[model samples]
Target: MPVNPPQAPTLSGDLLTIHRLLQSPTQIQRRLQTIQDLRFVADKILTARYRSSGGAVLYDVSEPIFNTREVESVAPGAEYPKDVTPEGAAALAAVSKWGQATQLTDERIKRNARPGDELDRVLRKVVNTIIRKVDSITISAVASAVTATSPAVDNWDVSTANILRDIETAEAAIEDLDMGYNPDSILMSSTKYAFMASDDKIATLRRRETTDNPIYGGDIEMLGNLKVIVAPASRLPSNDVWVFDSTQLGGMADEAEVDPGYTVGEMAVQIQSERIARRDAWEVWGRRITVPVIQEPGAAVKITGTNP
Candidate 1:
């Protein structure tokens, strides 16, 4: 016969009352302040920021394409050079709602004894879950918008891989556009970073006696002209690298919260709580109303097959 574990005793008396709940809305906000300090690479990727007006559901992303410039020496009184105009396109980014919730059951509260500790733990998890969702969404938008992809001459993990040359080629693609976009940032997984850091050429440069500066010290801060950003595999593919100008790449837009008591934060995350009388439980909920808009896809170049 199979044996089942005994159930935890129900929490009653003062514990069962909504008034006795350990986490009030005020307490939730305080906890959120501490959690909000964490930095997300996605935020760094999209340097441009926007706020949606109340009751707004969509954000318009403007894409401008510049044509070749005509500069020439003119006669003394000649009319000014021909006017320059850029073909423009726009994409509608639909704001999506993302939420995560955890229920604090009566049995769980009774088992923990300290309800405050339990609530804090659950609240942190709820917020983190929502943040991950937002990060994934932002990275996905970047990948989709950057339709240009350059396959590595050789896998980055291989001994023959010319990481520096590959990066230069990728950067050249964006610069060749002549649209004034400079590829200033590189996005990749930590695994690919380690591979690049351990490559023979990089190792040789570090050992050179003539130079005091190295490509990487404690962290992979800068590689040549590009600032390195190691993204989580959950957000960026481990086998791919992205080189782009953050200034022109894209941005994030979030819907403003109009609820009487709720105010949006830098991350645009909101936390809420509800009491269940019959079940004698408290529900912790976290949500974000946001969308990532890719404004200039040409500014970014994706280098795939960086890893095995």
Candidate 2:
């Protein structure tokens, strides 16, 4: 025999909403904790100091604007060279807009929160999220900078010899720019990292074996002189790789808000909080402010479809 199931209880509000219905002086809320990836890539190449919020245009000379001089059997003390060739100079500028993120907290809820640093931790994570978006925007700029005249992006091989060969070829392209360029960093996606790590050719040469330790993410450390960094999937695509000189690279220009703490860009603004009897809501607002423009594409070398 089945008795009528007691009617399920109905909540006056949804889990996402917090509206006070009782006159209780205190309320309690609990938050969950989780691990998040922190491998941000934009800072690696697009240095923060290079970033500007005043809407300044970046200007730089184009690489190899002048032809290399050819050496001919010169006559002893060739009658004082008539003229000297000057390296052509070109101006560069980057146009930037803004990227933003915001969060609203209920005052009543905050006051009654449990005795812990959870709330502060949550807010810190919000700030980090906004910065990561900047990284994504930077990578997009680099990818779009690709032009028809840009050096070829090759597909790498898995064998040990091929790996060294490809890396050399990629590095040489920038060094050959005759523009005094040297690749100082290499950025890749996790998928590519696994592909390289599993290569039987390099594995055979390994004198010691190591496994990934979650405390610190798996990293390649270095490949030749370039620092090997695994960029978040959001910033780097799985099939592509980029090698570039950090010295010549420019990054986001932003200022930290002293009173508060959010990074201020051209689009930065303060958001006010609202308070009413048992309810209070505060807001944070900002925007991503940087554009990646390759002033000298020659300094960067990208390879595509290595896993393929």
Candidate 3:
């Protein structure tokens, strides 16, 4: 006789148990949706911090100064009648206006500009939604586990590990979730060139050694950790060398003791080069990973016209 077909797994006390097992795939999908939501929230925060808001730009103002003067002069008087006349001179006062160069001053007005309208309320709503979604997914995953013996859901329980694993797997599955686009290398290169140009101008101003002192080099090299001694080259009683970075020159040619004529083009190149280096460092260290979206579950749900 043919054996009876194996009986299907029977559901026990609560309807939630049966519905949960049937909806496992849907639960995973929801978890991924939550992750995407979190990513969006993170992007908003980054944009708010990094993106510029068009704020007020102010111009410098000039003020004028004036001076006042008084003078007294005597005129010959005929009353004396002896070819010499004594007369009281009237006091005279004069006002004159002159233009003088003065330091320009500016006051900046504080701006209350915001990146987006109602940003505070929007941010609060986004934060609350993320918290609720994360909590709901976490709680549901734990509560539906087959091995759970109590009403309370324990997220760390081994029974819930599979759900957690699925979430991890889902996150790893996405391949296009970068938070920000990579910056252009050409822009970075230009910045580095500018930095180098500026550095060369700095090198010219440095004092040259008339006689050999430990601190003096024929030409300054832009070595990273080079130092300069403040003490005069001839007066050092001991051979002590106090060193300082070339940056201490503070962009003034007089301070560096070099002749004028450091071209602007050269300084521009150095500044650009330095900027490029900084950008490169960011490109290496600040890169963000993008999570790929697995469209299978969403696709299946779409095709079937069902929640799962």
Candidate 4:
């Protein structure tokens, strides 16, 4: 005969509050197991989608084709296939499988420097030299323009005006060094970004600084006021500020806040979402070529290559 099931025990408190009364270790364990199973299923679906999109599988074909093909021989010996059971899926998802996380120490260095810090002073000089180099290039390009007179006499004035406007726009961009964030720096590093400055320009500026002047006496006097000109050929604006924004700077803090409820899987998803959003936003609102190019100043005059 089959055994009879146990009858329910009466509770001292309200019967409606059944959750408090049914706190058996076995029941708790079972519920936890069920949750784990569901998580496993969710993980399998996610893993399949991920793998189908770009994941790859490696197999050892040395084993027998049919009955002898075991999971161990085909899949990684230590790392099992994520497509298997929920537990396996969960384990894969829970692990840190991404590249090493890095912090923007250079940005912090840029931001945390006091108004007169030596590093701050150095950065200012570097930026100013870049601006000067860009200005020189723009001037030279304009000076080399071939003069072009309109066939119709009436349009000559308009053409000349447009040429002047182009020059002004190009000059303005060279004057402003504020680009979006130091996106290039984030991809590379501050050292690399600084290296983009021409060696001659950097060397020239380094030799001209005052040894013991008040830290804030020159361009390095203000935190965000330093203007670094990029190469004119690069055509970056003079006012563009290459520094990190709040979101990029906050990444380290976000990673450090992980707790019990937050698994590595959740954090990875958040990071992916953040990167995607940042990339989309950058594509939409980042630096744009706003100025129209004018033929070198002498182009309209029909002068060949030679500046008058």
Q: Tell me the TM-score of each prediction against the true structure.
A: 0.78, 0.63, 0.13, 0.16
The prediction achieving the highest TM-score against the true structure is 1
Candidate 3 residue 196 Cα shift, in angstroms, is: 69
Query: Quick one: best lDDT, which candidate?
Result: 1
Could you tell me the TM-score of candidate 2? Answer: 0.63
Candidate 1: stretches off by over 4 Å: 1-26, 36-38, 53-69, 72-84, 106-116, 206-217
Superposed model 4: Cα runs more than 4 Å off: 1-115, 146-292, 295-308
How big is the positional error of residue 163 in model 3, measured in Å on the Cα after superposition?
A: 30
lDDT of 2 by residue, 1-308 (tens): 65587443343333233333111112211211122343346667765354444555454535454545654566886764343565435544554544343444453243443312433344345546655666777777766664312233334443432554566677887788677777888777776766665656555555554554222355567766988777666665335777887766445444333233332222222112222434344343434444554565566777654654
State in Å the error of residue 141, model 2: 1.7
Please provide the root mean square deviation of candidate 3 (C-alpha atoms, Å).
Answer: 37.0
The alpha-carbon lDDT assigned to residue 110 of candidate 4 equals: 31
Question: How displaced is residue 211 in candidate 4, in Å?
Answer: 34
Candidate 1 lDDT score at position 196: 81
Model 2 Cα shift for residue 18 (angstroms): 19
Model 1 worst lDDT window (10 residues):
55-64
Write candidate 1's Cα lDDT for 126-218 as tens digits.
777887888888888898878887778799888889888889999999999887898889998878888887788777755454343334346
Cα lDDT of model 3 by residue, 211-283, tens digit:
3322343322222222111222122222211111111101111111112311111111000000123322101
Candidate 3 backbone overlaps, count: 31
